[model samples]
Target chain A: MAEVTFDKVRKAFGSAVAVRELDLAIRSGEFVSLLGPSGCGKTTTLRMLAGLETPTSGAISIDGTVVNELAPAKRDIAMVFQSYALYPHMSVAQNIAYPLKKRGVSRADRDVRVAAVAATLQLGALLDRKPRQLSGGQQQRVALGRALVRDPRVFLLDEPLSNLDAKLRAHMRAELIELHRRIGKTMVYVTHDQLEAMTMSDRIAVMHDGVLQQFGTPKEVYETPANLFVASFIGSPGMNLVKGELRAAGSGLAFVRGDLSLPVANGGTAGAAVTLGVRPEDITLGAGPFACTIRVVEPTGHETIVMAEAAGETLVARAAPDSQLVPGQVVPFAVRAQRLHAFDADGRRLPLVFAQSNGA
Target chain B: MRNRSLTSRILLNVLAWSIVFVIAFPLVWMILTSVKPQFELFRIPPTILPQEVTFEHYHRVLVETPFLKYFRNSVILAVGTTVLVIVIATLGAHSLVRFSYPGRERLAQLVLFTYLLPSVVLIIPLYLLMVWLGIANTLFSLMLAYTTFALPFALWLLRSFMQGIPQDLEAAALVDGASRMEAFVDVILPQAVPGIISTALFTFILAWNEYLYALVLVNTDEARPLTTGVMNMLITAFNIEWSLLMAASVMMSLPVIIVFALLQKHLTRGFGAGGVKG
Candidate 1:
C-alpha cells in the first residue's frame, strides 16, 4: 500500500479544462471518494491518477516517488471500470488469472490462486462460465476478482456500482467497504452520488466545476462546510438560505428579511447584508418569529418536508411525521438560535456574537 | 395465442416451399443436365426428367481434356486469395476503427467506396502492371488479381463488426499489464470470430465467381481458372461434347455451394450482430 499525492495536477482536453489545478493527499490504506455532479471532473481526476489520462501540468506521486510519465501497466495499479469490462470470450477462471499469467506466475499456482479468489467472491461454480452466461451482478464480482488477484499497490474504482440495481448497489457498497477493510489497501473511488461518498469514504472530497470545494471527514463536511457549494451539495434536503440585512434588534441582533424578521442567536453588524442559513430540520413548524405559507408537503416516512414561502424566498421546513398540515396553510417556525449560520455577500461564513452589537 | 385454420397454414407452407424451390432450381438443373444423354440435353422442349442417365460425361471430363489442371489452379488461387484478404483486411480494419490518426476519415471513406463498388475498372491498369512485373498468365498473377478485388469488401465488412465491440475491454487489458497491441490480440480479436469467418467466406466466394479478370488476364489453359476453363470447352471441333462441358460446369460450382452451406451460420451471425448495434 502506498499514499497517493497529487501536486497541482491539471488535465485539459484540447482547450476545455476537464480538471483544473487539483491537490489532494490520500493517506495510505484510506478510502477516498471524489464526489461531484456529472461533467464536474471527478472521473477525470481518477483517470489521471490511474494513468489512463495524462495530466497537462504538475505531477502525481506514489509513496514519494514521481510517476508522472509511468504507463498504467508499469504503475502497478488495478482499476475496476464502471462497465465491468470482463473479457467476453474467456471463462471466469481465465479472466481472473490474466494478470497473474502476465506477471509470469506458475501454471499450477495460477489455477489455485484463481480458485481461491473465486471462492472469496462466491464465484466457485462460475469459473468455467463465459461472461455472457453470468448476470450483471455476477459479472461485476468477476471483474472485482480480477483486480484483487493482481494484488497491486493501489485499487482505483470508477463508479463501479452504477451498473447494478438499487438494492445491489447498496449491497455492493457494504461489501466493498468490508473488502477494503480486510485487504487494507489504499483505494481511490469516484462517484457522483453523495451518499456513496458519505457511506464508504474515510475522507470525502467534494468538487464543483473542476475545482476542489472541500476535503474532510464526513462529519466535518456535514456540520461545518467550507462554503455555500459544499453545504448545499452534501445534504439531501439541502441547507436553506434566507437573504437579509443584518441589524441590531434586541440584546444581540436580528435578520430583517423583508416583512418577516427573525432573531439571530449570535448575529453581529448592523450594515452588512448577510444570508441566514439553517438546515430544514433545525426549523420547527409550530410557532416562531416569522410566518411562512406552506406550498407543498412531502412525507418521507420519518420526516415531512414542508415547502414554504416567506419574504419572497422559497423555503423548506422539516417536521415530525405526526404534524398534521396541508398545502396553502399559514405556519410559524422557530430556529434553535445557536444553530444559525451567517454568511456575507461573497458567500463566506462569518462568526458573529450575541451581545456584541446593539441597535443600528 | 394461435388456433390457425388448416387450409391457411397449408397455404403458407406451400408458399414457403415454392420460394425455397425457386432459390434452389439452378443447382438442380446443372446437376441433372450434366448426367443427361446428348439427345435429351438439347431437346426442342427442355425435359425436367430424362428417361436415361449415364456417368459417361463425368468420365470424359475427368480423364480427357485439361479439366483437372484447371481445378488445381483454381483451388490454389481461391484459397490463397481468401487467406490474404482475411489477414490484411482484418489488420487494416482494426487499425482504422480502434486507433486515432490523421486522415482516418479519408481512409475509411476510401474503403467504403471500394466495397460498395468493387472496381472492375482497375483491370486494364493492373494487367499492364502484371505484365511489366513479368508475371502475366501465371497462377501468381491470378492470385494477386483475386486478392485485390476481395480485400476491400472484407475490410469494410469487418470494420462494421469491429466497431460494435466495447472499447473498455481493451482499456481494461492495458491497465492489467498488457500493451495495446497485446490487448487487441488477446482480448478483442477472440470475440471477433464471427466477423473474421464472414470476411474469409466473402473473399473466397468473390474470387471463386470472378470471371472478367480471369478471362482477360489468363491466356494459356495451363494457368487457366475454372471460370475461363468452362468457356474454353465451348470452342472445339464439330464433334464437341456437350455433356462433358456441363459436367465440368457442375464441377466448377460444387466447392462454392459446399462452402456456402457450411459458413452460412457464421455469416448470418455476423450480420445479425451488427443489426443490434451501431
Candidate 2:
C-alpha cells in the first residue's frame, strides 16, 4: 500500500477545464471518497490518478515517487469500473487472471491466486461462467474479483455500485466497507451518492463545477460545512436556508423576510445580509416560536419529509414518520438554536459560536 | 370467438402459402427446365416435373465452354477481393471510430461520399487507366476495381459495428495491461463478429455476381467469372443452348443463396434493431 499525492493538478480539454487546480493527499491504508454530481470532475480526478487520463499540468506521486509518466499497470493500481467491464467472451477465472498473466506470473501461480480470490468472493462455482451468464450482482462480484487478484498498491472504484439495483447497492456498499477493512489498502472511491460517501469513507472530498469545495471526514463536512454547496449537497432533506437581512432582535438577533421573521439565538455583526440553515431534524414541529404552512408530506418509513413555505421561501423538514402530519396543514416549528448554521451573503459558513454543538 | 378465429386463421395460412408458391414459381420452373429432357421441355403445356431428369446439360456446360476455368477464376477473384476489402475497411473504420485525429470527422464524411459515388461515372476513366498500366484484361485489374468500389460500403458497415462496442471496454482493457491495438483486437473485435460476418457476405455476393467490370476487363474465358461465362453461352447458330444456360444459372445462384441463408439472423438484427448506434 502507498500514499497518493496530487500537487496542483489542472486538466483541461481544449478550453473547458475538467479539473481546476487541485491538490489532495491520501495517506496509506486510508479510504478517501471523491463525491460530486456529474460534470463536477470527480471522475476526471479519479481517472487522472489512475493514469487513464493525463492532467494538463500537475505532479502526481504514489509511494513517494512522482508517477505522472507511469501507466496504470506500471503504477500497480487496480480499477473497478461502474459498468463492471468484464470481458464478455472470457470466463470469470480468465478475467481475474488477466493482470497476473500480463505480469508473467506462472500459470500455476496465477490459477492458485485466482482460485483464492474467487473463494474470498464466494465465486468458486462462478469461475467457469461467462459475464453474460451471470446476473447483475454476480457480475459485480466478478468485477471486484478481477481487481482483487492483483493486490495492487491502490484500488480505484468509479461508482462501482451505481449499476446495481437499490437493495443490491446498499448490500454491496457494506460489503465494500468490510473488504476494505480486511485488505486495508489505500482505496479511492468516486461517487455522487452522498449516502455512500457518508457510510464508507474515512475522508470525503466534495467537488462542484470542477472545484474542490471541501475535504473532511463525513461528520466534519456534515456539521461544519465550509460553504453553501457542501452544506446542501451532503444531506438528504438538505439544510433549510432562510434568506433575510440580519438585525438585532431581543437579546440576540433575527432574520426578517416578507411577513416572516425568524429569531436567531446568537447575534452577529449589526445589520448585514445572511442566510440561516437548519437541518430538517433540527426543526421542531409544534407550536413553539415559528409557524409555516405544510405544502407536502413525504413518508419514507423511518422519517417523513415535510415541505413547508416559511418566510416566503420553500424549506424541507425531516420529522418522525409516525408524526400525524398532512399536506395543506400549517404548523409551528422552532429551530434548535444550537443547531442553526449561519452563512454570509457569499455563502461562506459563519464561524460557529455554539462550539459545543452535538455535530462536532 | 376462439372457434371462429381458429378456422379463419387456417384459411389465411393456406392463402399465404399459395401466395408464396406463386411468387416462387419462376425460380422453381427455371431449376426444373435446366434438368428436364429436351423431349419433355416446352411440351404443349409445359411439364410440372420432368418425366426424365438428365445431367446432360451439366456435363456439356462443364466440358465444352471453359466453364471450369471460369469458375476457378471467379472464386479466386471474389475471395481475394472480399478478404482484402474487409481487412482494409476494418482497420480504416476502427481508426475513424476510436481516435481523435485532426479533420477526423471530415475524413469520415469523405469516405462515405466515396462509398456512395457512382461506379458508372468512374468506369471510363478507370478502364483507360487500366489499359495504360497494361493490365486491361487481367483478373488483377478486375479484383482491384471491385474492391475499390466495395471498400467504402464495407468500411461504413464495420464502423457501425465498431461504434457499438462500448468505449469503456477499450479503456478497461488498456487499464488492465493492453496496448491500444491489443485492446481493439482482444476486446472490440470479438463483439463485432456478427456485423463483420454480415458485411463480408454482402461484399462477397456483390463481387461474385458482378458483370459490368468482368465484361469490360476480361476478353478471355481464362479470366471471366460465372456471370459473363453464362452470358457467353448465347450464340445465333447454337440457339443460346437454353438448357445449359439454365444449368449454369442455377450454379451461379447457389453461393449467394447459401451465404444469405447462413447470415440471415445477423442481417435481420443488423438492419432491424441492433445497428451501430443502437
DockQ of the candidate models in sequence: 0.65, 0.45
**Candidate 1: tens digits of C-alpha lDDT, residues B25-107:** 97788789889988898888788986798888888888887888888988988898988887788789889888777899799
Q: What TM-score fits each model?
A: 0.89, 0.86
The TM-score each candidate achieves on chain A is: 0.93, 0.94
How well is each residue in B86-147 modelled by candidate 2, as lDDT tens digits? Answer: 88887898899888778988998898898777778878888898999998888888989999
**Candidate 1: which stretches are off by over 4 Å?**
A66-68, A245-255, A260-275, A326-329, A336-360, B1-23, B38-40, B43-47, B116-118, B132-135, B220-223, B233-241
Docking class of 2: acceptable
Model 1: DockQ vs. true structure? 0.65
Clashes of each: 0, 0
- Which lDDT value does model 1 have at A350? 75
lDDT of 1 by residue, A122-175 (tens): 999999999999999999999999999988999999999999999999999999
